[model samples]
Target: MKRGIVFIATLMMLGSCGIFLPRPEFEKGMTERRFLRQNRDAKISNLDNGKTTYRVDRGERFFVLATFEDGKLVKLEERESRPNWMTPQEDPEKRNR
Candidate 1:
């Protein structure tokens, strides 16, 4: 009975690894102004090529990057934040010197 319980618990944990991610409100062709209004605290970067990159940090290792052109959202992607050997931690100030 104990072995069955342990096996069931392990399976449950592994099954939850594929939790679904909700669809984001920002979509293609969304105007920059509208996006800004919806996400007041969004982080945005202006590029020299008239393209903009909007970063969405979910306080996790995974994040989203949205690219805009002609003042409209053109592309969106999910990315993983990996730490490099030079800076093994996410916070640079907290890294081991």
Candidate 2:
């Protein structure tokens, strides 16, 4: 009887895992804007596994960078500027200067 109860409990727990889990979906930087606006509070600064992310700020304006893998935003990194390699490509005026 105890063994049966344990098995049933285990099954119930396993079943619940699927119910509450997040569904996988491909997301892009532009696409995540909606989610970002919706969840302005408790915003998701980073997200992985192909989903949306939000970058929150105290001033209500936040910067975000969506990192893609295979054309999907597998992750999001928040920062003031794009990571690495400051070059003329980033700022055309720099080339003119």
Report lDDT (CA) for all predictions: 0.81, 0.54
Instruction: In model 1, state the lDDT of residue 10.
Output: 99
Best by lDDT: 1
- Which candidate has the highest TM-score of all? 1
Tens-digit lDDT track of model 2 for 1-97: 9999999999999998998876443244434444444445645545567643455443433465455444434565555653446543556877688
> For candidate 1, which ten residues in a row score worst on lDDT?
83-92
lDDT of 1 by residue, 1-97 (tens): 9999999999999888768665468789999888887777678755758998988776758777888899999998988887565465467766755
Error of 1 at 64 (Å): 1.1
Candidate 1, residue 27: lDDT: 88
- The reply for model 1, stretches above 4 Å from the true place, is 1-24, 83-97
Error of 1 at 75 (Å): 0.6
| Deviation of model 2 at 47, angstroms | 22
Clashing pairs in 2: none
Local error of candidate 1 at residue 80 (angstroms): 1.3
TM-score of each: 0.56, 0.28
